[model samples]
Target: MHPDQSPLRARSAPRHVPPLLLDIDQMLDEFSRQAVRAEFRFDPDTPAVVTVEFLAERGPGVIWRIGRQLLHRGLTEMSGFSDVRMWPTLSGERPSSWLLLETQEMEALFELPTAELAEWLDATYRIIPDETELDGLDWDGFLLGLTGGPGVPGE
Candidate 1:
């Protein structure tokens, strides 16, 4: 969410990473918590794909389309790796996505950063272990860890 060029303008289609595709819920959750704890960081190749549309004519429409995609698809896109994937938002909150790997994960991928995003992560993310651990910790990562996907960025 780098805003050096722009201000309050974040309207884009959310990245699509299927949730059921992986089951590393706990790890992802903690990861997100750490990120939120750290604040939202920006990167060139972030797991979460963001779209920013701030116009009057087609703004509402694009927002709807992108927002829906973000909420539905983006929400689950990072389900296993990026902490953002584990974000908490209303179920089926299409047009408004949730979950994304925390700043830590983003930084792991991209090093260049600003202090503002870090503060954002610190304010938003919070860890919750008791709730999601029962689901077996989303084994998608272990198998994928071998493949070199989100489970392992540069394997």
Candidate 2:
């Protein structure tokens, strides 16, 4: 091994946290109750819309979909959770058009219109059809953090 590339140096190197990242733990908790829908498009100029849905509690991880395209199968160990990256554009600090969902073996990137689209991904248990529904959810499954807020970036 090169002397300059010491094992200690490599271990000490910091991972690059993006300028904005929606909390991953929050997202996981949010999905545990119900499926949330989001929209994305491959191209900016074109008007094609793809609907993405988030599902949870299947196993150790979550699931995602784009329209009728079922991303993965049922009861599978492999799952990918999404990270909403907030990009600083000329307009302001808004959620980036792209999202990265990754797992051990693979990663999928998606394009959405704006950062606001990530509002549905919050872990607050914000979407309750009725107050009674809350009684059945597993509140203990959440591993929340102090960062990130629903519908806002870098909160």
Highest-lDDT candidate = 2
**Tens-digit lDDT track of model 2 for 1-155:** 68889888776524221122222222334234222334222211111112344333453334333321112110122222343222222343543343456667765444333333333322111322223334554444332332333534345
lDDT, candidates in the order shown: 0.30, 0.33
Model 1, position 144, has a per-residue lDDT of 82
Give me the overall lDDT of model 1: 0.30
Per-residue lDDT over 21-118 for candidate 1, one digit per residue giving the tens place of the 0 to 100 score: 11111123334522212112222232222232222332341110112223233333433443333333444423222333346424221111222322
- Give the best candidate by TM-score: 2
Estimated TM-score per prediction?
0.17, 0.24
Clashing pairs in 2: 95-115
Model 2: CA > 4 A from native: 1-96, 115-135, 138-155
